[model samples]
Target: MRIGIAGWFGSDNLGDEILLHTLVSCVRSVDESASFVVFSPNPDRVAALHRVDAERMPTLRARGAVGRQGTAQRAIRDCDILFLGPGTVFQERSPNLPWPGTLPLFARIVGMARLARTPVAPVGVGVREGGTPAGRRLLRVIGAASVAIGVRDQRSGSYFGARAQVIGDVAYALPIPDTQPAAAVEEAAGSARPTFALSMRPLAPDTEAGLLLSIGGCLDRLQADGWTGDFLPMAFGQDAQGEDDRDIYRRAFGNVLGLAGNPLNDREGTTLAGALDGWLTALAGYRLVIGTRLHAAVMAVALGVPTVAIAYERKVHDAFVDLGLGRFVVGPDVDAETLHRTATAAAGSPAEFREAAGRVARQGRIAREFVTATLKGLG
Candidate 1:
């Protein structure tokens, strides 16, 4: 069977890449001989990393050229099933204005599947409010076109009523390295200073300065308390649009002591699994993680690391709450002092945090089973 998987893959976003890797891995486990053609912004990178046939995602104008039978159209036409999303690709928001949002591309993909008489399924997708009318209309079309829609959270599932199953994030299915040391126990055996890692992404211009100040102040307090800080950038490269976590990290924490010249930035590789493995391995060393990226927080918890989530969006908030770590989340309105206090308290009880995270990780396996069952059903 041939599967045409499409979403935000091969964009140098570690989280999306990890989810794609996990999704492909899970599907392969169920059907070893299944062939895949993925749609991605960086098709060469995706092909190199995932070892799958990949075509560049069709641009808005390219959709108009569908009559000419482009590479993307051909891939979709040949597939038996079209799989869409394991990320926040269903949202109404678009980074660029005066342009069609992501929904149009989604609608176009489903349209291609419909024309080819192929089943389209969305796995571990996320949905949010405040979408444009065009976006909402496209989402409805997508919902009706899908054979089965699996959402990553309850909020996303509500959009499709009973058809959308809440399957949690697919990244949970990613295999954790067995060799990583115990969370807090191993830290005690290390040096006197406990390490703290901070992960941040770009925010709106109006709120960017304030958030940076708050994060810097929080990091300062942690440093004063004898904690060494490291900035972990989940998304790399300019192709990631405005969600450049590395650039944001450099702008916010570049000069901060113990954070400057950290080697984590140099650890990523061409392969998605290798990059994720390196990230998780490095994150396991931190006693506390303050993360704005949802996948970064999820990955940290998967490795049994204590994480304090800074919820810039509902997905981040919902994921942490589902994991039973709601107490560690601070909203966008949170002040610098509150962030410091929360991080300090969260860092103090490392054992409790680790235990809670471990419990959530155990529950996340349900998502994997759901994926396997869904794929088998498709067959």
Candidate 2:
């Protein structure tokens, strides 16, 4: 069997790479003989790293009419089925980015797959809240094209209604090493002050001042409590400079530790690029984690780190709920005093948090099963 996957992969975003890697690993667990042909933005990098045949994802302008042929058409023809999985699939807006949206791009993907007579199954997809009228219609077309659909959370299901099964994040199901590096764990415990991991992304201009002030204030309170933090960037843009999250996080904390990286995009640490297990292992070493990115929370929970999710988007909120860490989530507008209290409460509740995270990680097995079942039907 051959599976063709298309997503925002190889874009210098570790979170998306983690999602892609986990999905590929899970599929192979069910069918060792299966091969993959991926459609990626950076096809050469993906092909080399993933050991798969890859082609550039279709350009957004190519309309998939009855007789036209292109890269997407040829790849779709070769695969038994096409999958739109992982990452924030249906987001219509970005905080500061200038791109229009994904609706039209996905419409073309499903359209090309439809023309090629290959089934398009959307599994482990995230649906962002709020959509334009035309975005809504394009989504219906994509849903109608799918053989089966699995959404990342209950809130994501609202967009697709009954057709979208609530599949937990497949990335959460990604396995981590059994133990963290002793040095990492020792640093967290052996240091004079406890240290937490912190992650954030770009916010709208209106929200930045208030959010930064509160975040700064919260870190100040943690300082009083003898705690320190590190800023970890989940994404490093392909443009050589780091992503906005790196900058935002820099402004949020005065004395936070941050690793310097080159154009290599290994924002976490050296030897961490494209390695989910390694990243999770480093995350496990932290006494606590507070992050605005959904996967930052996802990765943290999977490692059973005490976490506070600052929900910059609804998907982050929904994911924490799915992880059984609902109470740890806060909106971006959260006040410093409340955030300080929440952080202390989380730090105090490690055992309970670990228990909840383990339960949810166990449940993540269903994601593997769902994909296996989807493939079984296709076979």
Where is the poorest 10-residue window by lDDT in model 2?
A: 260-269
Give candidate 2's root-mean-square deviation (CA, Å): 3.6
- Evaluate model 1: give its lDDT: 0.77
lDDT by residue (106-152, candidate 1, tens digit) is 78778878887889989999876567666666776788888888889
All candidates: TM-score: 0.90, 0.89
lDDT against the true structure, per candidate, is: 0.77, 0.75
Query: Mind giving the per-residue lDDT tens digits that candidate 2 earns over 1-379?
Result: 8899988876666777778888888888988888998887677667666678888767754455333337668879889888897767777866533344776777788888888899988878887666777776777778877898888887666666578887788886787778663336766567766778778776776787788888888988998898867787777655324355667755655356654232235333333235555556667777788888777877877777788999988888877776667888998999999998998898888886778778667767888888888888986
Number of backbone collisions per candidate, in order? 0, 0
Candidate 2, number of clashes: 0
Which pairs of residues collide in candidate 1? none
C-alpha root-mean-square deviation, each candidate? 2.9, 3.6
TM-score of 2: 0.89
